[model samples]
Target: MNWHGLKAIYLHEMDRMRRTLFQSLVSPFISTSLYFVVFGSAIGSRITEIEGISYGSFIVPGMIMLTVLTQSISNASFGIFFPKFTNTVYELLAAPLSTFEIILGFVGAAATKSLIIGTVIILTAGIFVDLHIEHPFIMMFFLVLTCVTFSLFGFLIGIWADNFEKLQVIPILVITPLVFLGGSFYSINMLPEFWQKISLLNPVLYLVSGFRWSFYEIADVSILTSLITILFFLSACVLTIIYAFSKGYKIKN
Candidate 1:
């Protein structure tokens, strides 16, 4: 299993995070806090509550998911991308580490960072609005699954990227928009009936839906659907990673 190699790589990534603590951690925290301030003050005025949950409280789950999703990808993608950028990946490939160990170390650390940020965001949200978890276990399960799954997805991004700019492409152009449009800030029910159906197609909706469900027991879709969606995404990311490694995509070269 190469436990020593795995531990070394894991510590290296964690150390890197510590070194860039502000950019890696505090930046997202500050940004999300602003969402509460601006959105809560502005939007909260127009929309007092959604499904009886206060506007600020209603957006808490979505806010956390938004941060966790983007941060997971950024953290994991940059963690591996930097090594590739510096031509240090070849050294990692030569080390006494199996592919599984390498992935576990990098992805695990990314997930851990996202999870910590998620918890902190939750606590920070509590100060703004009343926060309660009707289903703490389910809330945690979704949180962990989201972090790990997206971390794996980010790992693929890290491997696929050959340059620095490519790293921002998906998170900015794709992921961020998906979150904002995917019932993160507002319930899908508020949309017209036709648009509500369309919202179902956005993958992040299921995640935000189920996550919000854990807090208030209300969701745009069934909790089962959300669980299946994340699991399916997780499986797909795993398969894609295996294929990428087999073909040596952006790695062996």
Candidate 2:
């Protein structure tokens, strides 16, 4: 399994986080605080509750998911992309590590970082709102699954990217918008009946729906559908990563 090689790569990525502690950790924390301040103050005044949950509390899961999703991709993508950018990936490829070990190290560390950030944001959110977890186990399961799934997706982005700008493309142009529109800040029920059905087409809706369900026992979609959606994407990302490694796609370039 090349445990030593895996540990080395894992530690290297973790060390990078330590070096950029402010950007990697604190920045997200501050941004989340601002979201609470702006949204809780400006929006909370107008809408007190959604489905019996306070406006502030209602958005916690969505807020956490938003940060975790973007950060997971950014961290994992940059972790591998930097090595490729600097031509250090060939050295790692030539090392004793197997493909699985390499992926485990990078994706595992990225997931860990995102999880930590997500947890911290949760704790931070508690200070502003009264929080409850009807399904703590389910909440954690969704959290872990989201982190790991997106981390793998980020790994693919790392391999596919040829320049630094490409790294920001998906997260900015695609993911962020999906999250904002995906029942994150507000429930899809608030939308018109037709738009509610249209919201279902956005993949992030299922994710936020399921995650929010874990917290409040409420969701825009069925929990089963959300779980299935996550698992399907996770499997797809894993298979894509395998194919990329086998083909030596961007790695050998």
Candidate 3:
């Protein structure tokens, strides 16, 4: 691995984000706040607490997860997509860095942005509603894990997409619907037997449930199971990317 090349790419991506810090940072924080207001206050008031936690508090992790997932995907996807679109990727391909190094540089930067945005969103949630952490370590662990996994998934999307419109199709059309239906606002227990079975198939549910467990010391699914699911997804994404790079799919062509 060429450490210098990795550093160069990492620094370049970080600087690009810094240049648009306002849109990249402030906008996500504001948008998360609106979710708390509209869903946390308005809709939350109508729904009773789940598993003894208040409705507003119950959705905090899901809200935070939502922002982390979307931002990470957008950041990583754009990081690679723009370079490919403008033909700058040829330079990267010719660089001394290995494929792993290239993935780390861009994905790491994307995860960092999501991590910062997620932390800010958590703090912002506190202003509107009192927050508590039943397991601080677990909360931080899952936060970082969620960021890394989604960033890699974003990297995959960037490689697969050939245009700007195609780039957004995954996050907007696929991820968004999966998130909303993934028991973000309500517990799976609240659903009928048929729907509850179906909800289990949505991977986002495990993430939200795991994150919520960190906050309330409780979850709809077991924390161990959630952890395993996250690991499985992360491993799968890494393998897919490795195969893509080895085959020169999208990147070489």
24-85: candidate 2 lDDT, tens digit per residue: 76787798899999998789999999999999999999999999999999999998999998
Off by over 4 Å in 2: none
The model with the greater lDDT, 1 or 2, is 2
Question: For model 1, how does the per-residue alpha-carbon lDDT over 13-109 read when each residue is reduced to its tens digit?
Answer: 9898798878866776687789988888788988998999889899999999999999899989998999999988988888988777888999999
TM-scores for every predicted model: 0.97, 0.98, 0.98
Evaluated at residue 22, the lDDT of candidate 1 is 80
Regions of model 3 farther than 4 Å from truth: none
TM-score of 3: 0.98
- Screening candidate 2 with a backbone cut-off below 3 angstroms (N, C-alpha, C), the clashing residue pairs are none
Q: Which ten contiguous residues of candidate 2 have the minimum total lDDT?
A: 20-29
Deviation in Å, model 3, residue 168 alpha carbon: 0.7
> Model 2, residue 238: what's the lDDT?
92
Answer with 1 or 3, whichever has the higher lDDT: 1
